[model samples]
Target chain A: MGPPWWQAKFRGCGYRITIAREVILNTLAKTEDHLSAEDIYNHIHTKHPNIGLTTIYRTLDVLTNLGLVYRFDFGDKRARYELAEGPKGAHHHHHLVCTGCNRVVDYTDFIDAEVRLLQEIEQVLSKKYGFKITNHLIQFYGLCSRCQADG
Target chain B: MGPPWWQAKFRGCGYRITIAREVILNTLAKTEDHLSAEDIYNHIHTKHPNIGLTTIYRTLDVLTNLGLVYRFDFGDKRARYELAEGPKGAHHHHHLVCTGCNRVVDYTDFIDAEVRLLQEIEQVLSKKYGFKITNHLIQFYGLCSRCQADG
Candidate 1:
């Protein structure tokens, strides 16, 4: 892992690998939960008090634009983010968001049927609508086990 | 029909079916494409100039909260609104948004495999994570035929 793919991606896009950007990327890469900018700022504040919330927001915007991070809206008005390619490997996945608890589960256990269906749908839509299909975002919203149990 | 499902829903929730709300709902109900608050206001403004932008925004908020409308962010900063149950029958669908031209296509042609996979996944996720799944949002982002041809 020569400086990680994201660093290379930053360089490829002519973006500087500033400390703020690097820290933000590392934080998202290491954490499993979806985090808001304010949450991220809190996570980095004690260790990097100089890293302003504004910088985190701007860096997130840049990273999201570069496809290095994914911004999610779970109908909570606030945006949450997670790394596109995380420590969990290169396996692409969707999300199961707990609307009750704000917990997010990455659903990576893609069955053959699911994969085939997606590929087929892409082909069908592309042919039907003449779209050069690129990618997709899918999220299921509900109550997590703990939240249900609590209720 | 005595009243539309959404109108009943609003009444059930004790929200008055005011003209502003009714006009906003009618506008979204008739239009096929997604509209921002401004777009919706502009559309209604010509005929109903008395309906202010603030009222449009408020009604949209109310309608969205009532699950009568869906709010979408297509990677653009602007939010788009569409009826949850549109004039195209009760068929549930996803969206295919053009990254270039901001065109949105509703995909309702679900194959058996697609439907089965979703059902199976919901079951699996519910069992595996103890998530009582309620709903889902899925959108595919891509370039339309014209955009491809233009390039």
Candidate 2:
């Protein structure tokens, strides 16, 4: 509608507004699920048949460095990318990855108790290890209902 | 002196034991840190010069499929391996990955409250999403003290 996160970030950083980068970022914005570079290429291949796989990977690298995208590793060989939350935004989402079916569920329902527990953990680690933890990715691997019934 | 996890699992499942598999499992058991397949191969390559990278990967696949080892993707390209907690054991550890320095800290000091919070989250997710939760991996990403200071 107005300006996507990537556009604002690129403008602030003085980076060029290239077509390839725009297309990749737009594809990510439209995705409901976290996607790998291959997945992105496939999604845009019909419309942007000229875009090569290498271009997609390189653009993702640039977007990640610009802090417009967050890359996650879900025990799969490939890395999945999602839009970075806005400035000062809480990275509060957790992923539930089904081990049996490889389906990922993004969980945003953080109860107060769970949030307090994580804050405490961060405080402890910061004091004990002297590390300032900025973000956390928690993934619970399990079987979905269908897989559970099948197993 | 006693049989390790891989040995028992293989024996129970009637799978053949090979030198490559044994070496990889033993290497993982001896380390307190997670290691990639290349790291494992490099550690044992001098003694077992005949072992090929292909063999190491195939053996890891077999061990992983048997539920004898755990595979982790730390937002790095390669997958890291660790021995699975024994049947009666608890793999209650999490990790802190330093984005600036590429350092990984294994955080194992899980308190009762933290454990309880995770249990509650699992229960809530299972009830709402119908997922059969099994295992979890939690990683906090940030700059280490030195990295933060340097930045």
Give all TM-scores, in the order shown: 0.84, 0.84
lDDT of 2 at A33: 81
**Candidate 1 per-residue C-alpha lDDT over B28-65 given as tens digits, one digit per residue, 9 for 90 to 100:** 98887789999999999989999999998898889888
Candidate that would win on DockQ = 1
C-alpha RMSD for every candidate: 3.0, 3.2
> What are the runs in model 1 whose C-alpha is more than 4 Å off?
A86-91, A145-151, B1-6, B86-90, B148-151
lDDT score of model 2?
0.81
Q: A1-151 in candidate 2: lDDT tens per residue?
A: 6765457778888788888899998888777789999999999999999999999999999888987888877666678998777654446577899887788888877646666777788988988898988877677888889999998
Candidate 1 interface RMSD value: 1.3
